[model samples]
Target chain A: MSKPFLSIENMTQTFPDGQGGTLTVFEDATFGIDKGEFVCILGHSGCGKSTIMNILAGLAEPTSGVVKMDGFEVSGPSLDRGVVFQNYSLLPWLSTLKNVTFGVKARYPDWSKAKVEAHAREYLAMVGLEGDVVHRKPSQLSGGMRQRVSIARAFANHPKLLLLDEPFGALDALTRGTIQDELLKIWGGTEQTVFMITHDIDEAILLADRILLMTNGPFARVAESVEITIPRPRNRTDIVEHPNYYAIRNHLVQFLGQRSKELAGQQSGGEPQSPTRVVIDKTGPAPDPEPTTKPQLRAVND
Target chain B: MLDNLSTNQRAAVLSVVMLVVGLLIWEAAIPAQKAASELTEYERLTGGGAPKAGVPPPSQVLAKAWEQLSNPFYDAGPNDKGIGIQIGYSIYRVLTGYILAALIAIPLGFLIGMSQVAYKAFNPFIQVLRPISPLAWMPLALFIIQDSEASAIFVIFICSIWPMLINTAFGVAGVRQDWVNVARTHELNGIKTAFMVILPAAAPTIITGMRISIGIAWLVIVAAEMLVGGTGIGYYVWNEWNNLDLTSVIFSILMIGVVGMLLDSAFGFLQRAVTYAE
Candidate 1:
């Protein structure tokens, strides 16, 4: 198999618990995201999902292991890794347009001011914020609108990878749906590699090509990487009806509900194993039901 | 009667009414003139002929205010300048000192806020020095600088520096981590992040510090000028008091209040400008 475009190998993060003992947030977590692939990480709180995203973004260093993007070891924050924080971390003092322009200009300093502004506006328009709304400050905009600006800013930089830390966690259901669709539309146009962290299973199914489920922490590991086979241009309304949807959904729900807790109790001996990969197919015939252990499906013809 | 008005308007009307009533009572309480025939032999011997030596009536103070204001900037002589010139001197000193304090305090504040080591090292010194009165510096400043004008300016500087320094440090330290993370993700360097992200984020708090500083500076300038005995509103009040010109003293007091309010409101406007709802 070809080398993954973004690889996180055995990353462990620990903090001093102030009692002279080290508190391990997560340990020996391993995952890889391919180029132009959209991957979402699913975990309950305290599973170190944000810590993993922060490591990928280069905002924080893992206590051990490395994050590699485009074959280079990530060290610190760079424009090549764009981030969309859940709080819609737009510079509050800048107008929406200026905020986007600020990043665009930083990315392409040689570009003319007009060119930078035009590029920013284009991204803003892609996120459905156009005309006068772009001139308003984040304070003047609604919460959904602010998040849209943040997405626009991240996309406008044209980073090699986008790290979204629960980007829609704060939005209501309706707003989340709209922004998710907008994000997918934008992602479809660019084929951007994305690593997103979220607790929402439906959102993961809606946006990601693959979902990485993380077990509960202290020594948490990425327990499984569920490959989503839902076809492209997928609609939220129609996705659940796909034949593979229920199989994939049930597997994810079962993993999160019971398997996560069960795996957390099972102490692996040495270095943790890579997450098991599961593939779901809508048109393929079902394999014989194995009453012993979970059946691993055969690789499909792409 | 105040029911139809907004709260501020009602308060303003009440203030005016209270002022008028207070003035009438004051005018009535002090006899307009001493009864010349009822003067005691001791009063006659003591030459008590100084217009009864009472607080000047409101009408007299109002007349003096109009006269001084009509030619505020007139500079007949150092001691005989118009009220405007006196106030101008005081404001210039306050601004010069306040600006110098800002130049030193803001960058230093950023350093202190950004570094725990610096904060720990400097906090005790700041705590000890901040509470000492600005005028308390006047004697040493005069001894070293040996210039009354500079001493007055130095006093204003001492008075205004603490608030701005503390507030700026607090504001810079309090910038949201997420915003800083955004700056880092954009690959902004430290300088750009400071100017573009941290500065704007901390501006409102810094302005609040500035507001407090200006109010204190204004207050201290009056006292400083009084101590130095130079040409300022504060000095003018002292000089008028020495001359027993109660009307002029009252007029200068009103001017000081008005100017102080203007200085405060200017900072208030700036604070609002930088303030973000979030």
Candidate 2:
């Protein structure tokens, strides 16, 4: 990929045991994210998605290898990398305007007070908050409103890279859909690179330019990189009409299901697992997505 | 809001009636002789006769209060200085001591809260000093400062510092790690992050501590003044007892109660003003 904007190479993380040995969480893990790419890392529980994110954020150190951003070694947290936490980490004492302004003032210290405030207000409005509502504290706002403010604060800085650790995992399905739309709209408006961790297959399929599927446990690695060719301005309601959408979704489902089966087989060496893979036209007529066809698993004879 | 208040008002009115009835029963239960004893004591002062035994009236004390309250700034006699003058002197002492205490205590508390090493070093000293009564400080204060007014102020200072200090420390310590992360992610450096994030986040708890400090300050002031024998409502009550002016003594007691209530209310209002919920 001509040296992606961000590159992680041979990253291995090990936690030291009190007894002289080390527990390896991931080994030789590697990935690269290009500029303006929306990448979702998906895995089952305990796959070290958060661990990898923390490593990239410089909150935690990896045991081996390096993470480079724009061809510079990642050291500590930087203004170049903005993070939106899943918990909506809005400081309660500050009003929405002040909260967003806090980020702007820090990143752009040379900017005058009026300029900082105007920038904050513009971002708040971009996230759909009106002027009257901007004055209210986080406690006074609803859950969704708080998350919106969080997004505004993160995006306001226009950081070179944005990391979201399951930002919408805590919301309800309906709220999740609404927020997903908002997120897409906001992403469409910006050129920042995004890497998000998600458990929802649909979310990964809908939001990402590429979905990085991870294997289950201790030696977790990106098993597959699925490129989504779904057209631009893709609305979720109409996304199903894209022919490859069903095939790609089915492929991912089949991949995850088989990965689970392979692990189970490794433990017992029972059946010959054959995970069925769907190959369909990337540019062809779309059919109504069906739920009846359960993705069949095929064996990869390791 | 009006519609929401009807039931609340009904409950409040019911409680008021209950309180009034309880007071009436208390008044009725007092024996005639005891009532007369109370009035006789009241009568001994102000050169006013005791009320009828059955009903110990408030008019006579009210008149004495009015006499003291009117021209509240113009000293008419040695014992007849305006109530406002006395109250002003007391409030002045309290403000001087309390503000001084807050100024020192809050920042110190924040520092202690922020650093484990500082907290470990200073916490023992705070624990030891906090329990020593403000009244106990009175004797040391008198011996050192030598002036009753200064001693009284010093005692108030000692009494008020601990709550604010502890609260400030706790508030600062309890600020969320997530907020700190946000500040760091935004590239806010140490001092700026502390000011913009930590201080504001900890303010509610710190203010609550101040409220408690104020109430304690008011309570300690009366005792401090009484021990120091100064020109405050506390001293006024003690002086009347010396003069066997029981009515004046009771009046001073009422005045102390009212002033204490006002101080509490003032702090309560401040707490509300500063609070912003998450």
Candidate 3:
């Protein structure tokens, strides 16, 4: 296989467990995300999902491993990787448009002020933030709107990789659906590599090209890379109609519900633990897709 | 009629009534001045014709205010300067000292706030120095600076520095880690992050500190000027007392309170500007 666009090689993270023993949040975790792929890692709390996300974003370092993008080792935060934090970390003092422009200006310093502002307004528009709404500070916005501004800020920077730590975790179901759709639409246009962490199984299935299932900590490991074979434009309402949908969903549910705990706290014995690839396909030749899965079906040909 | 007014308007009306009532009570409480003819030979011989040194009525103080305020900037001689000129001198000293304090405090506060080692190291010194009265510094300042004017300003500076420095450090240290993480993820350089993120994040608290410092400086300036006794409103009050002109002294005291309120409200406006709801 070709080298992935972004790769974490044997990344381990441990903390002093307060009794002179080290707590291995996750050990010898190895993963690769292909370019233009939307990958999500789902595990219960204490599984070190956010730790891995922080490592990938270069906001934190792994205990004894490296993160690389485009074959360059990542040592610190860069414009190449943008993060949408879990709490919708938009600067409260800046208006929604200025928040986007803050990142845009940093990413493209040579760009003119007018260009930066226009670019900010455009991405904000994509997230359904426009006009007066864009001028409101984050505190003035609803939870969903704040998250949208955060997403707009990240996307405006055009980072090679976008790291989202449960972007929809704070939203209600309806708001989550709307923002998820907007995220998918924006991601479709940009084709930027994405790595996200979420606890929601349905959200993972709906958005990710592949789902990386992580076992629980203190010896957490990435156990499986489950491929979501549902074609785009996967509809929130209709993706379930696809034959591969429930099969993949059930496998994920079974893994997270049963196997995650069963496989928890296992040492890989100094071996780099990569996920076992599991692809579920129930389509026959010229398999039919539901008409509602439009924009268009990127059919996984059987 | 009062029921039709808004809360603020009603409160204002009540304030006016209280002021009038207070003035009427004050006017009535003063004993009638002894007639010059009723004074004994000894009192007359000792110049009892002059107004006795006592708390002047509000009406007398008001008349003095009108007289002094009419031509405040007249500088006839050293001890006999106008109220305007005296207030102007006091304001100059307060602002100069306050600005100098801010110049040193804010940047130093940021440094201390950003580093745990620096914060710990500076804490003892701040603790020791902050509590000493600004007036206490006057004697040492007089000896060292050797100029009363500079010494007065120095006293104001020393007095104002503590609140601003402590508050700034607190505010800067208290900036949310999430916001700093946002700056990190954006790849902002240290300076850029400080100016764009940390500064704005800490500004409200810093301004609060500044408000506190300005109030302290205003309070200290009066006392410092009294001790130094050169050209401030504090000196004017002292000089009026020495001359036994209680009307002028009361009027100067009223002027001092008005000026302090104006100074504080200026910072109040600034505090409101920088404040953001989290």
Candidate 4:
């Protein structure tokens, strides 16, 4: 089979548990993401979602295995992979315009002063940060606006892989809803490949083309790849009304609330643990393709 | 009427009231001098009527201020240099030594802040040396440098260096890792990262250090010039004491205060410039 644009093979990470023993966070985990795909990884805390994101960003290394993008092995952080951290990590000292321009200039150093500025302003405008608002520092901005600038900064670079580690985690639900809509607006046109970690099931469904569900850790692994069957141009209000939305969400909710823990720490015997492929479509006549999962559900039912 | 005034205007009114009250008391406290006509000829020749040698009243000091300020740069001899020239010399020494200290301390502090090993290695020396008085180095400095002027500068340099070095290291070391990670993901080189991310993040802290250093430098220069004893405001004050010119001493003391306040406010402006709310 042809390799996907980005692939992880047998990734494992362990830390000395400070008692002269090792604690394995995750092991023999594997996955692949095709170009232009929006993938979200969902798990309860401590399932090593962030560790996986870090490894992909080149900010960290796993104890074993490798991550390759575009036919080459990933190493230390590069401009190609941009991250929007949970804390909104906008440089507090710079104005809104300069923060975006700071990244644009670094990514395109050869661009002229005016061109760099115009490019930055273009992206800033995309996030609704124009006029006097761009001149204010991050500290001067509200939490939602700062995140918008951070989003602007990340998107302006047009990175090969954009990583969002719960970028809206710090904002209130109201503000979160607004930025999510704004994010959807910007992301629709960019077709940027995204890998995000989210705790919100509704959010995972709202934004992701596919949700990669992780089993609970110490031997946690990517357990299932669940595709969102609802057609796109999806909105927060409209998506919940779709027949397939709840079908996909319920399957995810069951796996997370039950199977994730039941399946935790079961190191599969001597093989890479690729997630099972799942497709849920209640819109039409019942058609389940993966017969292997039927008995597993039966066992859980019993 | 007071209720109608703004806060700053109210404060200004209070300050003027306090000044008038204090100056009136000062002017009233001196004993009255007997007229020359009332004194015996022997008392006159023997100078029993010499002006009382005590704290000069504000009026006398004011008059002296007008005289001295009118030709502040005039130079006749070492003992009689103008207030402006004397103040100019002191400022020159302070700034020279301060700037020298900054040129070395800032970069060194950046190095120490960036490296845990360097910070640990240098901590012992800084702890041991920082508390020793800058004046205590004078005898050693004088012997080695063999020039009083340079030794005085050296004193200012030593006194000013510690605060700057320590503060820079602290500020630089304390910069958030998030910012650094941002730099890395941007593919910024080491130089660019240091300039773009690390410097601005640490700047408020570093400028705080600089403000402290300048204050110390100003304080030390006065004492240092007193020890070296030739051509500064410190020396001028001492020289006036020797001449028993209480009025000039009082005036120069005020000038010292005025100059120090200016230096401090200059840094205050810089600190505000670099400060961010977060």
Q: How many residue pairs collide in each prediction?
A: 0, 9, 0, 0
Residue pairs that clash (backbone atoms under 3 angstroms), model 4 = none
TM-score to true structure, per model = 0.94, 0.83, 0.95, 0.96
Candidate 2 C-alpha lDDT tens digits along A64-90: 878999898998888888898889999
Interface RMSD of each: 0.8, 1.2, 0.8, 0.8
Best-first order by lDDT: 4, 3, 1, 2
For candidate 3, write residues B150-269 as lDDT tens digits: 999998899999999999999999999999999998888899999999999999999999999999998988888888887989999999888989889889989999999999999999
Off by over 4 Å in 2: A16-22, A258-302, B1-57, B76-80
| Off by more than 4 A, model 3 | A285-302, B36-51
Individual DockQ of the candidates? 0.81, 0.55, 0.78, 0.79
Please give the RMSD to the true structure for each candidate, in Å: 3.5, 7.0, 4.5, 2.1
Candidate 1 vs candidate 4: the DockQ winner is 1
Candidate with better lDDT, 1 vs 4: 4
Q: Which ten contiguous residues of candidate 1 chain B have the minimum total lDDT?
A: B45-54
DockQ of model 3 vs. true complex: 0.78
- Superposition-based RMSD of candidate 1 using all C-alpha atoms, in angstroms: 3.5
Top-down TM-score ranking = 4, 3, 1, 2
CAPRI tier of model 4? medium
**What is the lDDT of every predicted structure here?**
0.89, 0.80, 0.90, 0.91
Q: Which is the better candidate, 1 or 4, if ranked by TM-score? A: 4
Model 3 chain A: worst 10 consecutive residues (lDDT sum): A293-302
Model 4 lDDT at residue B18: 99
Winner of 3 and 4 under TM-score: 4
lDDT tens string, model 2, B178-258?
888888788788898889889888888999898898888888887777777647767777777787776677667778789
